[model samples]
Target: MTEQYLGLPIGPADTAFGLMAEYDADQHLNKVSLIAGAYRDENGQPWVLPSVKEAKARLAQDQNHEYLGIAGSPALINVAQSLTFGSNMTKNLDKSIASIQTVSGTGANHMAAHFLARHLRPKRVYIPSPTWINHQTIWAGVGIHIEEYPYYSAETRGVDLEGMLSVFETTAEERDVVVLQACAHNPTGVDLTHEQWARVAEVMKRKKLYVLFDSAYQGFATGDVNGDAWSIRYFVEQLIFNGEPDHPGLCVAQSFSKNFGLYGERVGVLHLVVPRHLAAQGARSELLGLARAEYSNPPRYGASIVETVLGNEELKGQWLRDLDTMSSRIKSMRRELRRRLESKETPGDWSVLESQIGMFSYTALSQKQVTRLREEFHIYLLPSGRVSICGLNEKNVEYVASAFREVIGFNSN
Candidate 1:
């Protein structure tokens, strides 16, 4: 009784954030950080996109601090909706799509969990085996029984699609919620092939599972926004317009954090889509109610920057080019790392380094090896051997690769 009433136990710190804090205090001149999903410039510094810089300059001439509406900026949402579904695609959606701007992707995801846990009330929610560190934390807060589906296979170094689909067919029930990464999957950068995506969609549509797409990486993945969003678009066409009206709906939690480099400004949108036969206005109103109870309103500065850039033709073109520049740099770094590792004859198959996409790579280095790298070599990366590829640049690429060879070099366990 005394223990119950006294005080709560201290919770564990978030692994990524904790490691980031440790990195900041290390003070080692040669220390390299492969933590944090945030983007870094060629000089290993935080980058403000050219489009964002122009938008900020525009705002300086006419700046004001004011609260956005409960649902956030209308212009921003419209542009966001277009970027996600494409103008032509959204035109076909018409009244079936309901959207609201949120604090960011985390907020969008949290809001989705809360709203779905209360209303949709699924019997279970299925998440990937290894995912963003916060996925389980967010769902646990909503009081839903969570299940895991096999996502990656360390043996094949690729997606375990058969294992994933088998679980869905065997254990997953109707109306169960399935969380999916829209593009550039986190931790492990493995994603499904087009045919693989179609297979999963077929199983999902047949089973009537509600899909919650986490669209944190859109244009950032392949520098082609339309190509990155193909899965979501395909699913909508197959499930909503083609499936039953009674089929549970799907939602997309879109983030501008990566694509627009608006990480700090916290700009995101959640779009809930119902079957073509149903009206979404009622659902939209309820979402507004949920938002009102939460942050009261979303941020203003980031939304303005994104809207200004996307709403204009020239600025939008510049933004597209910016995506290409960032993605190209990451890809180049990947190739260099893999080449250097192979040239030096480092241990395992280093080809995966080049194949994985986006900001992170899941180096097969074990936890013990990762610890040795941090302790002996002054390098920083997640214990799971995940590294932010953006952390590598021209100056330090060889040093980092050499460090890898020293730690797990040639035929050593």
Candidate 2:
């Protein structure tokens, strides 16, 4: 056997496993856990939305074991369409939109990237500089070149909007694909204001660029579905109102993990808004073909639960209420963390934490400080100092704030 086959190379997982084993054996391991993803309840436990439980109950009584089509559950797909594009989206129901269920957000991204690589043939896909770590890996895995656009500015702890627009304006026409976070941006929790989104849409339209929206936290972001969907809805509206029937724009990847509290279930949708000129049946057939080769069909359990909740008025209302509860808790945690940090008179402006929305806060700590936070303080977070705000509660917010202050405070001296 060749050397490559004889000895497989170590990957990130091996490195992570080794590092975690050492930490597991160390004393004082309970200080903090450094997981960057995954939503936790106030008690630092995995959460299952109450609406999901009720939906599961309804599905269990007369559930069919029959295999879903390669494109996944039709009812689930319909519900997904309605949830993202709105119930009254004329273009959506008119067959101008093509949607397929996928394993989850990551899967949806992969599917879209593959399609773009094969069909769109853009020079490269431009992703945010500090986007979800998996984004680069996913695009590159499909043999597509990946480039970075300015996103988070560490100094200001906010978006580098001007820098971002500059890159987009100079991008060669029809040669770039820009991936946008549809709602709450991950890792930083910072989001674009309505005005900023409008500006971005206008620039992209003028440049004739393609857009791929990753909406991982739609309802979870603000507990208001329409509020979270404002950017995407505006994009679609722009295309329709402009009467550009053949506009070469608009694709969306939506995840049910965060909002539905269905993390491990791997449920998501990949949709494309095709030109009105294309035969509706033809567009749907093409999208389904893509799904046929990728995963054959998405799992039914999660999709069934989603459809059950969303298709029923009472269950949908219940789901919204549950989402509000989750959003409220995270909002309270942000305020409390800000209050605690301010009380300590932390050197830098910690006000950004309060201004930023969503489940995380980019704490702006250097990699060295982040290391100390983990090694000495047992406070777990990404090396970039992004903390899952959902992990904080009445019990741990003060402790986390104090640890943060101590690290930064000592560093300043």
Candidate 3:
């Protein structure tokens, strides 16, 4: 009886973090870590943006530690809103938008799941198959019925747009929740083209499905912040601004981690947009209630830093340069890795490396090859062969490419 009450099964460790621990323990000098989604400089070191450094300097003179409101810093939320939706849309949103500050991208996602699961109470939530690993776990934790729609195509090494839209047209119901990564899709860097996005939006609008846009990599994905946010803006214009009244609205979970290099700061905001005629005050209140009960308030310093940078014209310009620096480096590394791999006559198509945008690529390496790369070469990536392009630097790109060739060229199974 006591055993029954006290015993609970221990869950498996998180794959990325667990592997990170293993990599840390390995004593190999040339060991390379391609596991994390975080950015790394050409020297394979975590970088602090110049804009961030300046913001900290400004805050240091008058820095004060105090608990923020449950909704977080209004300044940060304002800038964040403008960042995600652009100025015109933010102005037009007016009363229909409900905004709140959360722990980070993860917290924003969890809050959205909790609020929607309780209030919207949809029949099922549709997530992309092989989405960010956390998507499934977040919705599942909220006790929502989860369904996976096709996302990527292994055959073409691109977004499986037809299959994804098919699922929406055939299976999804009105008011059902669908998760969409706004830009720089995690795991697989492939994103839907503008035409493909319009198609998906049309089907979603017709089906009256609720969209939860995960805007984790807005400015960070490409150098252009506005371009990165094209999908979300397009969706709002079609679904909310010009959409039906009865149609359930959408929400955005925005993170500043990758964009601002504030991963540890845990700064994020959640925006809930109701239908055209509906005011979001009630929904905003409910969100505040949930936020108050959970973590009380969001972090202060990080939000302050972000607000400082974005609010200032000079600092914001510097921040834009910072985005270019990170994105350009990732792009160059991708090209180099592809070039090296092809020059050695590695089997399979390596073009995907250059074609795919953002920090990650679906290398299409088998599970056996992944293991061999780790055990033999001490290079680490996810089991699904998703490698973080940020992990490849000037020093390690050749080594990583050579390892790939050795693993694929040998096939010692």
Instruction: Indicate which candidate wins on TM-score.
Output: 3
Every candidate's lDDT: 0.91, 0.81, 0.94
The residue pairs in collision within model 3 are none
Regions more than 4 Å wrong, model 3: 1-5
lDDT per residue (tens digit) for residues 1-413 in model 2: 44666588746663334544655666783555545355678787788898999998887786587778988888988888888888888345466777888889988898888888887788888899888877898899878788899998877778899989998888646637889999889878889898888888887776767889999998998899989988888887775445355457678898999999998889999888766666446656766788787667789888989999999999999999988988899899889988899999988888887898888888888888888877887776777677778878888788888988999999952
Q: Rank all candidate structures by their TM-score, best first, as comma-separated numbers.
A: 3, 1, 2
Clashing residue pairs for model 1: none
Model 2 deviation from the true structure expressed as Cα RMSD, one decimal place: 2.4
TM-score of each: 0.98, 0.93, 0.98
Candidate 1: list runs displaced more than 4 Å.
Answer: 1-6, 410-413
TM-score for candidate 3: 0.98
- Comparison by lDDT, 1 against 2, better one: 1
| Candidate 3 lDDT score relative to the true structure | 0.94
- Top candidate on lDDT is 3
